[model samples]
Target chain A: MLGAATTPAEARAAFRGGAVRPTAGIAAGYVQCNLLSLPAADAFDFLLFAQRNPKPCPIIEVLEAGQLESEVMPGGDIRRDVPAYRVFRDGELVDEVADVSEVWRDDLVSFLIGCSFTFESALLDAGVPVAHIDQGRNVPMYRTNVPTRPAGRFSGPLVVSMRPMPAAQVADAVRITSRYPSVHGAPVHVGDPAAIGIEDISRPDFGEAVEIAEGEIPVFWGCGVTPQAAVMASKPEFAVSHAPGHMLITDLKDSDFQVP
Target chain B: MLGAATTPAEARAAFRGGAVRPTAGIAAGYVQCNLLSLPAADAFDFLLFAQRNPKPCPIIEVLEAGQLESEVMPGGDIRRDVPAYRVFRDGELVDEVADVSEVWRDDLVSFLIGCSFTFESALLDAGVPVAHIDQGRNVPMYRTNVPTRPAGRFSGPLVVSMRPMPAAQVADAVRITSRYPSVHGAPVHVGDPAAIGIEDISRPDFGEAVEIAEGEIPVFWGCGVTPQAAVMASKPEFAVSHAPGHMLITDLKDSDFQVP
Candidate 1:
């Protein structure tokens, strides 16, 4: 029960006591969020960036500057809750650690963004096969030709995660995912890598590439990596984010966002 | 023909030349927005307020500080586009004018918020008769006991607009309006207004009260005026907003938000 917690609070508690690993399969039924903390000076700009591009940056919750506990996840300390965190300075990754309390600042404003894992779980629940999850690999992510609406100094190309499914089930997959709008809802693109300016399917900009079988086509959903890409491009003097694949498990269940 | 323009641009052009009045039933096919312009210093707080209370503050577009034109309504001027604007200083109305060019500042950020007109249009299109519109009166708005999630200096009671429909048509109205998430997607309450702490059924804090016919239920949806209430309560030093019922007609159509 140590690594396999059933609730988000338990999972966060476990991670708080030095559980430094990815959080993919932990707290299975809860909502997992992508974390982004920026200095108060830049919070408005980044928030505007998220507001302009909601598909890739669907905000779940925003903790006011210096606020530790989220209303959604009460008594949870964001600094010590996540399994791993990556610290950046001048747009470069300077440190990756299990606890970010050492570097946390009073003026840092945190944003919890919706992740694809919730929708992927929904897809799996609906019997739609997720190729990357099936292969025990990371979902394929690519940089697209689509430019995000710039806000202040933050601007970047849209990043998307691709999952291949049989052409017959694409409609069902879309239907299932569309219900969870807060979690990067619905596929942005369905059939072509070249259409969104991707040169190769095998090599992804982030995450591991997976196989697309015969009779299957690549479907893309707006990835949460987009804001990170903006942080890299815009070079916001200081920032904090969850490490790749490591996420903050929130107390809310996916059912909360299931519109129907 | 001059006052009966069918396009958003033409309607805005007419308003620019001192055609000051309410914008209901104008350019019926397009969307109308509630305008809220604040200085750059208060932009973040207001934006955060809108984000936290999205049901009542669905944003259509945000024009940055000093930015004149919106990408959604190119060739349009923010100062001269709307039929009427109410200028407020320290939360008290100072003037109501058609053009705000003289009072406009270089650091003012304007937010175009989704108005109920779009969804009301959709509801009427779906054959769900709206009571207020039937009587040619304003939708009754109430100050609910439900407190909105506070953001910075922005916090106030959730204001809701009521529409009475036959019990048989309530479902259709909800189903129809739910598609337009950008313009208050679904009803927040149906039936007894006392559930949300409304002491009087006939009295409303804002807008005109209309009759709830026999066999009809009083349905309430989040209203756009919630932000104005916050402005009144929080008392920002300076703000500009659309006069009650006077909205900015945008180029986008209601169908654009009519998600299937």
Candidate 2:
């Protein structure tokens, strides 16, 4: 198991060796990014979509067509670095694999987006408790009735992850998280599941749910899963993405994204 | 004669009527943008270029291929709303016109980039003196030896505008302007001009040079003109850009882009 002292290169090496696992706590202070690779034809559309909806799809870096290495993650082969990769065809899940070097195409343009792990660390650091980490479970996420500003063929409903906290600490969470706009900054909604189209607090559309303790209100934030949801709903001809919780560990420090 | 009471729509209306004038100080407190329109084939390349060099080319909004109306500035036509437009063919200035409606192409994609005018207003509001405004001359801009991160067919030297301020207020200017990253946020260099490769401070490559009074130092911030310079150097088949100092006034207020 990799811990706080693990470097990003070491983490990538471990993943390249077939370690299929979530990459949340590994290389603690460094940034982890959600990956989405698409054909050159669909690259512009996805880029526009992400640009129009920056809250949920904050782009860290975009690798040009046929480019494999990233400026932020130098000497890294994107095809085999992430622990897991999800292959999608016409928007349907075709296969899940540990490496995609054989299937990778020359015209594929990969985009690395900011993940919630960076901001989640800031929350925990600020004395604001995260329910999922405390309960040893995946974060609860929901799809809302809100429609994102669509670009080209990419369009979908807004997705959010919820963290239940004491009503008193909700503002602190908002203040701390808002400092990092690159990683789904600030909460979208603070209370009432129905307000954002969630039917039940106990059941989530994705990930495991934790109890909202007495006197705690549910705080909703824009989720990184939004781009993946768009891929499923819009059904692009081909796409490659990291499995949930499996991310490309980048060299940028968390403080590198913090705003004064 | 537009001033503090002017609305963006009215300012644009004046331009649409063949007022070929610079847009500085026209729509006070509202966001003004540098416009760059390119053929759809080159859109991705320039987008990548701007993404890589955000300090010089901070994008505010991107209009899809052949689309003109902006989300931030509704009821405004891209071709007719700007005070002046520059037509470029194979990297050469072919014409300067008041309206581009006749030459507009169905496949052209327009990019609205953040302008320093937004932050310049913030500096004034914060009690920092602007020498160019007081002298009634343009902010002096220079092309430096600093190379921007190249992307596709777009690449050029970083361009910066100089604003000389009292040494005591330099920190205040930096603190106030850094809040607006969308408008070329933060100074790229502080004191010595020779450190950044500028040979003579009085002779600027672009814009009129202003005198740096005693006890004042020239501070440099990334200029929005860098993208236009790239367009000139790369020699693409076709391109359209706003005339320098002639900008598109948008509906977004200056404070709309202010960070906490």
DockQ of 1: 0.53
* Correct interface contacts retained, every candidate: 0.05, 0.40
Compute the DockQ of candidate 2: 0.67
- The C-alpha RMSD of each candidate to the native structure, in angstroms, is 1.3, 1.2
lDDT of each: 0.89, 0.91
Number of the predicted model whose lDDT against the real structure is largest: 2
Q: Chain A TM-score, candidate 1?
A: 0.97
The residue-by-residue lDDT of candidate 1 on A144-236, one tens digit each, is: 999999999899999999999899999998999888888998899999899999999999999998988999989999999998889988999
lDDT of 1 by residue, B1-260 (tens): 43435688888888887888788878887888999999888888888889889899998899998788876787899999888899989888889998999999988999999999888877877788988889999889999999999998889999999999999999998888888788989898999999999999799998898987889999999999998988888888989999889999889888887765
C-alpha TM-scores of all predictions: 0.98, 0.98
Candidate 2 whole-model C-alpha lDDT, 0 to 1: 0.91
Q: Write the per-residue lDDT of candidate 2 for residues A11-30, one digit (tens) a residue.
A: 99888888888987899999
lDDT per residue for candidate 2 within B1-260, as digits (tens), equals: 77768899998888888888888878688999999999989988898898889889999999998687877889888989998999999999999999999999999999999999999888988899999998999989999999999988998889999999999999999999889988998999998999889999999988899989999989999999998889888988899999989999999988989887
Q: Name the lDDT value of residue B142 in candidate 1.
A: 96
